[model samples]
Target: MQVSYIVALLALLAVTATAQPFLPGTGFLPLGNLRTTDNGGPYNISLLTVQANEIKGGLAAKQNFTDKDIVHFLTNVECLEGLFDTWGTFGHGFNNNLTLGGPTPIGARKANLSDAVRPFMEEVALNEQGHALFTRQAGSDLPCPPIDFTGGFNKYFGAAYNLTGNDTIESKFGAPFDPFLNDECYLLSVLSLEELGATGNKGLTALLTNPVIANGVAGLATSATAQATVQRMLLWERRNNTVYPFNETVQQVFARISALRDSLDGPQMDDQGLVNTDPRTIAVPDYYVNMIPTDVRGLTFSRTPQQLINILTLGSPDGVGVFFPKGLYGAINKPTGFNVSASGLDSFPSSGAKVASQLSTQQIGTLPGPMLPPNVTGELDLTQSLTGTLDNGTAATRGYTIIPPGMPYFSNASQVAVAYPLQTGSSNASSNGSYAYGGRRFF
Candidate 1:
């Protein structure tokens, strides 16, 4: 009986082994063997290869965007486009005049830009132009707003330093903080703009939904970040060099500018200087250089559209401040009451107090009288034609039409209430603690 049982068990094992080969869904089928029937016909092989347009269309359809969503997306895109346009124009203007034109209002002699730094500045300008082009293609049609590179810089810088008349800037720094005056000034200006651009782009990534559009924005953010990094590296190299006429070093100026920007953009300490000033924070070899501005997690800081507007406007809660005198041409152009001061006029010098008061009373979208010359020219024309080849070897003409004007501007009071519902309280404690540097945490 035992012999019979053993033979039966062996037979069962052999049957199971043989059946395993034919088990359901157990083996891979050859590609040739796989077939599909649709409408009583064989599947078309051409459908296997998906096209770029089809994917984009599918993603857009899936999003099912509403009017509000479209408006928000366009606003963000137009803001970015305007920023690139301004930067590109500034770069071109700088390149056109390599030397400091004349002494500042204070009669301080300016230094010359070295040949070595010219190429880098040119590259930044070209990259900005490319960025503008890409954003234009992506769907921004707002014309370039009036930019006040000369007077704007002076007014903002004066506000930062609390300088009122000719003597303050000239007596102290031997200059009036003119960006086009020297290499140091040019670099400082570039650093300020690029860092803001990088942070703004980083903020936009979270709001974008369409994968294609998000990918394009991601590319822009990456480029802006790289530009900012290059500027910081350059500034770090010149950290110890004395800013002409001033008793302060280049790094000290960097810190002051950073502090000013931080103050303008609400109470957050999102900006950073070239050097690490905190003694409690620990690093190997006492890390003093801060090449990248980041938070506790080593992540780059981001700013909302409102915060960015505040900085551009020199802390003006309303639009029509420095950089963009006429204000941006999109829905996100208006500022919320999240600047250095609730009124946005406290930072202005005595000379600008009247203008600030006038601007404060003006309604949103009301174009202020051109206080400064529209020195920065060149608009993003939609009729501009781009020639390219399609994937299937066919010629294609990629053209864009002007996006219609943004939705009517929101009321200033409504914008303020909606944007910043809760007023942030002041905190004197430093946000940058030793815990950020991987040091011992008291909590």
Candidate 2:
């Protein structure tokens, strides 16, 4: 029975996955419906994956070791198994739609395809999953290192690589031009290349031959001034400096997006006005051309080889993990407590540089775009709280590290909401101190 449900759910996902886009090249391939808070509720994967039989069987099956062996579940399935693309960047390079360059209003805000898919895929994006996977596997082994977090405070924009002379990747995001890597822009940009297949070594070459780019391509401007237009778009993106748009729109930007908001969410238009002007499909504007440049002299689209969207999204390279030698901050997934290596640092900088270059590559990368109410965590029903003072007489907080009960990490922005409570009076104060273990980070 449990197996039946899993099979059924997979079928449903497969079916719905084939739904026609409201517009052309509008569905799948680009970001899917995973990330929208409102839209994703009905299709919540948690609800979908839950099977009565499985849960019952998980605990019984793995009586010795299982989150619930009734059904004997495998808690630590490798993220590699979930890899859809050769490079594993959202499994891009397949027959997916190019993120449409238009507003898709859903409720209070207008979202692009990328914005819409975020809520659904957020957890499984592999970026967070990497940490979770590592932590889940961590045990007696010299203790796991903390997550590498680059303290992104969002201030001061348009600066050099590093004021410290090391060209360290300063949060790379700031004000004025919002949607820093936090937005779905990267997803939007990436989905277009989904059909490149598992080993898309020649995917870019195929894209070039599609007739949407330089010399002759769809959505690419056939006009004589097309080259200048592409150049202008590139310059605009550089000026904006937001590769992954995170912040919402400004007055003017909002107005542009506003026109389509009502129509997108409220009514279903038969006409999905996504302009498929990619050089592979048709003549496009300099916007598309410069944004997704295919015309490298003497090079075919397949030769350029579009990197997997995941690579573009989360930064690339399979083995060379990011280096935090100088003690990084709390934003960019900083591998906590790990001794940084120079070779590791040197090797992956190239991949990081590629992602960096790709991000601010075109004007449109600048665009678009959290949470829930929680669950069970209580020490005891009684008034007495679990408190033990340190030998130095310094009282410790109720929960250790404020890392949240189920979670391993603490205080990172994404997980900041899970706060560790402070018991004021004394370690054994009244033997009764109860506070919300992990709620939204208020302070």
Best model number under lDDT = 1
Error of 2 at 45 (Å): 48
Model 1 compared with the native: what TM-score?
0.52
Candidate 2: deviation at residue 233, Å?
16
lDDT tens digits by residue: candidate 2, 1-443: 99976875565455344432223322212111112112122112222211211122222221222112100111111111122111223433112211112111111112232434444343323332332233234221121121111121111111111123333323333323222143333232222222111112222112222232212212112221232233223323332333433342221122122122212111111111122111111122322222332221111122111122222112222311221112211122221111111122123322221211111112212122211223212201101111222221111111111122222211111111111233356332233332222222111
Candidate 1, residue 139: how far the Cα is off, in Å: 1.5
Q: For every model in order, what is the number of clashing pairs?
A: 0, 85
Least well predicted 10-residue stretch by lDDT in candidate 2: 69-78
lDDT of 1: 0.46
Query: RMSD per prediction, one decimal?
Result: 24.4, 28.8
Candidate 2 ranges with C-alpha deviation above 4 Å: 1-115, 118-165, 171-181, 185-282, 285-300, 303-443
